[model samples]
Target: MKLIIGLGNPGKNYDRTRHNIGFMCIDALAEKWNVTLSESKFKGMYTVVHRPEGKVMLLKPLTYMNLSGECVRPIMDYFDIDVEDIIVIYDDLDLETGKLRLRQKGSAGGHNGIKSLIQHIGTQEFKRIRVGISRPPAGMKVPDYVLSKFSKEEEPVIEQAIEKVVQACEASLSKKFIDVMNEFN
Candidate 1:
């Protein structure tokens, strides 16, 4: 089984915030595939969907962002999945808005969630699909800015970006990481 995990904080308040875009993309994928994240183990919400290629389990870590690795390791061990079969989608403050980047492995680049995952998994070899959230305007605190919801004007663009990421993910699952980068990066 392939595991596609999206990182974000759980609960109502964090629902539509900028930091929750990863959750939003996974939610979209679940809806598109007509699957439900009904399972409640490994500290996450997940569902196994039978796509044409094979079974894909969509997971949203319930460890609430920073401690997300704890939620993924057990699941990875349970499934005997290699780092190659896993993909993580999350927000990236370093990239520009609406831009996406695909990498087979890399440093977390200061993302707490990815940092934790690297620490627990003992490697940075898993694939990452980073969606740009852009850095905050000058004078704004990074945490406060990321925790905030997008402005109405930014919603359309975000929606499009999510769509692109979803498509990129599907391509990655089938064609390969290099193909996804060529097509979406």
Candidate 2:
């Protein structure tokens, strides 16, 4: 089974914010697969879907951004999922808005959520899909920028990126992570 985790803060207040792009992508996937993330467990919301390749568990952590590993580690342990079978989707400030990057393993690059995951998972050897949110403007705080919603001009771009994220998740089930990265990154 594959564990696909999208990192973001929980609740309506964080909806559509730049920091919540991960959640948005998971929502998009749920809609695409006709599955509902109605079950709450492991400090997160998740649902399992049986695909041709195998079973896939979609998870959206509810432990907020900084402490996301708290939710991921337990769920992974409970499910007996290997670290390599995990794929985390989250926002990145290094790439331009709407861009996506896939990495098999790396440092968090200052993302608190990824940092938490790396620490708890005790390794950085998992796959990751990074949806770009772009860097904050001059004089703007990183936290404030991430918590803010995208501008009107960037909405369509973000929507397209979310669709790509969904496609990447689907592809991961049948193909190697490197192949998926080559196709989408």
Error of 1 at 77 (Å): 0.7
Worst 10 residues of 2 by lDDT: 5-14
Query: In order, how many clashes per candidate?
Result: 0, 0
lDDT of 2 at 36: 94
In candidate 2, stretches whose alpha carbon ends up further than 4 angstroms from where it belongs are none
Candidate 2 per-residue lDDT over residues 136-172, each given as its tens digit: 9999999999999999999999999999999999998
For model 1, how does the per-residue alpha-carbon lDDT over 87-149 read when each residue is reduced to its tens digit?
A: 999999988876888898999899999999999899999999898889999999999988999
Prediction 1 TM-score vs. true: 0.98
Poorly placed runs, candidate 1 (over 4 Å): none
Backbone clash tally for model 2? 0
lDDT of 2 at 118: 92
User: TM-scores for all candidates?
Assistant: 0.98, 0.98
Best by TM-score: 2
